[model samples]
Target chain A: MANLSIRSVSKSYGAVSVLDDVSVEVEEGSFVVLLGPSGCGKSTLLHAIAGLNPIDSGTIVIGDRNVTNLPARERDVAMVFQSYALYPTMSVAENIAFPLKMRGLDRKTSDEKVVAVAKLLQIEPLLGRKPRELSGGQRQRVAIGRALVRDPRLFLFDEPLSNLDAALRTELRAEIKRLHQSIRRTMVYVTHDQTEALTLADKIVVLKAGRIEQIGTPLSLYDDPDNAFVAGFIGTPRMNFLRATVADGGKTLHAGEASVDISHLATRLEAGRNVMLGIRPEHLDEKQGVTLSLAVDVTERLGSTSYVHGMLPSGETVVAERREDQPRFGETITLRFLPARTRIFDAQGMRIR
Target chain B: MATAASDPTRHFFQPIIVCLTVASVALTLFVIWISLHDLSLMRAGREKFVGLDNYLRFFGDPRAMAALWRTVLFTTLATVVEIALGLAVVLFLDRDFAMKRLVRTLLLVPIIMTPVVVGLTWRFLFDPATGMANYLLSLAGLSQVDWLGSPQLALYSVLIADIWQWTPFVILLVMAALESAPTDPLNAARVDGAREWQVAWYVLLPMLRRALAIVALIRAIDSIKAFDLFYIMTRGGPALSTETLNYYGYIAAFTNFDISYALAIAIILTIFTNVALLTMYSVLFPKSGER
Candidate 1:
């Protein structure tokens, strides 16, 4: 296991920069996930660390060595590609045993290691099957086995579960978490799936436009994002943002027919300043202290929880989490905001501390 | 032509087989009728039934046996050498280079040139005293070599010309296969600690095995029936060193005027070539259950 330190790493293709001076510190035996939307350079940063894609600048320090210029094999990093990338010609055992064989390990020992990895990944019965003969989930397990058999210093995963079906993705995601638990190696994973990042990461690095937006624990990032983009990107049924103008001499925010009192807002703002008030769906309650009201337009029930989508008089929609029942479309509903949980971003998108 | 209305997509084999069977039966009847007779160009229409005499006489002829052996040797050598050399060139030029497009275009010149042109060009180049081959030998302080005159070197001179003309054909085929093969497995091999050569041998080459087999099959078939280069360069000269089966069949019909025996030789050569190629194809692409 090794701690990975990426310092001022930047990569560009022609004039377009893909990773602009991105840096992250991952502790040994921790799982760090780079989470972002498409074209956000999370995959590029992972490739840079793996040495598959060379960085244009900066150094990558792993353990005690600076391996910035080392080739992928020389760096002792094994990758699980999104496509699985198994050798189609080789059987599962040979695919898993390849790295050990390349390192010149004895056949007997290598075979034993292959069996151990196969058992770990629960792919022991598939040892004789070619990759083409295996299903997507089975291929994923074999790819993991290949990476695990190497016992590399750091493991890099490039959206390894994106291609699988939902059930299989969840299954593999949990298995990967367990693998990290058992092996306790430093692993850096890249994915655009926020749920996977929230579930699998010890530290989540949120990225946007080739730059790091925030780096923190998953809950910290979800609860306290650094900017409007980070706030918008981290959660599903995403954080609701309402354009509000300061009113009542810097004491309240007014938007359409919904007005939220800003008297207890953590940050002081001058009167007439414009800001976006962000709140999570579950935080919008009918029985909380600070409150706003909007007319209910639509609602959806997902068994235990319900999502209530309401519309302001100005024709803007806002979602709230309700229980059991929903109001009619024409009915007005009062939603109280948890003052401690609400976030405000300026018109320029900077977080209002 | 007056058959009932039929769905075009659903029943294509009926019409196809009807046409194919008519053509096939007529051709087979003609070949078999001629093979059973003592036909010759000089004899005209005074032909008589000879049964299996022509086939038996062919197996007994020493020249015919030697030509058959020469054909097999030439086909095997040409196919193997051309594929190996072509693959080597493809690998050498696989990477980015300043003049890659121009070089690829230039490589096509050899393949697109007519076989007769290639044959005459190599013949001049192999001229004993004044040709470029001997000129290079002189430059290296060696004696002028008889490239096509000596019996031992005559077959090889024709073989070299065949390779020079056809290796680019293999290169073009294998290059297209290489271009479309997925590079993810190869990149994964590099990340899995495989060296450059190991990645090529284990991942990249295995991926091209099917394409290489197809190119080898084509080159093998082409080599077996090759006559233009031999006619242009050697013409089975230098004590019959390059007298291949196809050329021997030519000699039987035109020079010896034994039309029946030449037909027999043609039939036997076709069977041999088909059997050999079928075996090769089966080996390269075995039945899925057989593995």
Candidate 2:
């Protein structure tokens, strides 16, 4: 296993800069996920790491050697692409054995390794079949097998499971986790799905507009985001933000007709200062306490849990999970927010007290 | 009335058509009657019902057999040269470049020019003493060549001129196929660690096989019955070196007044063309069930 270090990488096409001064360190035997929306430079970063695209300025170090100028073959990195990139002309066995042949391994050893990887991915029966004959999940397995046969220093996956259906995606997600546990190799995965990044990564790098917004463990980013963008991007239903004014010696945040107690907050707060308060939907409860009255607009019940999408007194939309499915449309109910579960951000989107 | 209205085949030959058909039949019969008035002359006034004697005489003639062989040789050489040049031009223009649009438009100059005009132009350029081709060669101290004088070199010279004029037809079609090829597989090849040459050879060329087959079919069919260029340039002169079947038919019917022999040769050429076309179709559209 080798740690991959990217130092000050930048890329541009003509005048449009795609990746600017991006740097990250992927520890050995760890899963590093680059997460972002489309056109946000996540795939470009993965391509740069795989040596498919040349960066304007950067040093890409795989273990001890700097592979900044080396071609993809010399870098000893295998990539699983979004479309699974299995050679249509070759059978699964030949596709898996391609990298081994490229590395000058003998025929016998290459076949043995191909067999081993096919078995690991449970695609042994598909060895003789072409990619077109297989289903999407099967194609994905062959793509991963092609990467595994090389046993390279680092493995790169660019949305390898994006083409699979939701059910198949879950199945392959668990399979990949188990594979990582068994092989314990350094892998850099790039995806726009936050769930994939949260579940599969040892360290998640959230990006926006070609810049790294936050990099941390999943729970850390979930519990404590650095800015409004990170807080909004990291969670499932997305963190709810409300415009509020600090008042009463900074002990209260008044938003429309409701006020939230922030007296126990350790960070400095000033009166009359404008700020944004964020709370996750799961943290909202129906118990009577300091409450914000909201008019229920719709409740989407997903058997055992329901999401009450409603408007708060401030006219801002908020989503709250109803554990017992008790809320109905047109009902105005007061939803309680725990003091410790709230996060505050200044007008500039930076987190504040 | 209902039975007559429900008959589906009623429109097959609605009348006013039957009267016209009878008139056409009578006219064709009268023309055939006048044309066959001197049919005995085709058999040297020997007897009626010649029974394939004209065809037999054509097969027995050394000049006819030589013309047949020369036609095959020219077609083969011209088709091969045309396909190779077309494939080269296609591969070159497939990529994006500064002057690609301009070059593509310019390449159409040769293909769009009338074939007869192109042939006449090349004939003038290949003239022995005053031609530009010989002028350039003389400047290099090479002997001036009689491009259409020698029976051996005349066919080859015509083949060169035809290749120059028609290779662009193949290039335009093949270039379109190459440009729209899926980018996913190519990128996958690179990420799978393939060299650029390998990607071009294994992935790209195989993907272009269907287009290449079409180009070959078109060029071959056009080359087999090539007449206008050959007739305009040499008129089967310099000892009948470039006398293809089309030109041979023209000579036998018009020049030698052997209409029966000409019709027999035309029928034989038709059979050859039909077989070639069938073979080409089967080769291009094999029942692989890809659809």
lDDT of 1 at A108: 97
Candidate 1 Cα RMSD (Å): 3.2
Among these predictions, the greatest lDDT belongs to 1
Candidate 1 has a DockQ of 0.60
Candidate 1 wrong stretches, greater than 4 Å: A247-251, A263-267, A328-331, B1-11, B96-105, B127-143, B289-291
- The digit string of per-residue lDDT tens for model 2 on A67-184 reads 9998876788888888888777678998888777666789998899999898888999999988889999999999999888878899999999999999999999989988998999
Interface RMSD, Å, model 2: 2.3
Residue B126 CA displacement from its true place in model 2, Å: 2.6
**Chain B TM-score list for all models:** 0.94, 0.81
